[model samples]
Target: MTLAVFRSFPDFPPYGGEFEDLMPHLTVARDGTPAEMRAVEREVREHVPISMLITDVQLMCGSNALTA
Candidate 1:
């Protein structure tokens, strides 16, 4: 399942979700290897649901940058 919107957690463990200048995005692929991620993306386009609800959230920093 996947969502195409931003989400936030009220509070997360360890650091309590207090990072600065943070933004959330829909996670398309969770695979470690780039090849595996690509394969998963293909499957996601075919089988993922149109809508999804996030239950629990774990905050983390990613290296990717968002562009306009």
Candidate 2:
């Protein structure tokens, strides 16, 4: 799996390398084909800058889908 890492908009407060304080980052995209990824890259390169507001965050494991 590959991660397209990006810095947060407006920036997050930095914590002097503290383990408990996680780096402020948002994973833009997960694993994808090289062609698909290149498309995204092209768009990003051509588009103007934008801000992303992240309200909620969640994490899940396992590749298979799970029912609610």
Q: Name the best candidate (by TM-score).
A: 2
lDDT of 2 by residue, 6-67 (tens): 13422322332235535455445566999988888788767546566756644332444232
Would you estimate the TM-scores of all the predictions?
Answer: 0.33, 0.35
Worst 10 residues of 1 by lDDT: 1-10
Clashes of each: 0, 0
For residues 1-68, could you state the per-residue lDDT of candidate 1 as single tens digits?
A: 11221333333322343555444446765546888888878887896455657676444544442221
- Tell me the TM-score of model 2: 0.35
All models: lDDT? Answer: 0.50, 0.47
Clashing pairs in 1: none
Off by over 4 Å in 1: 1-25, 53-68
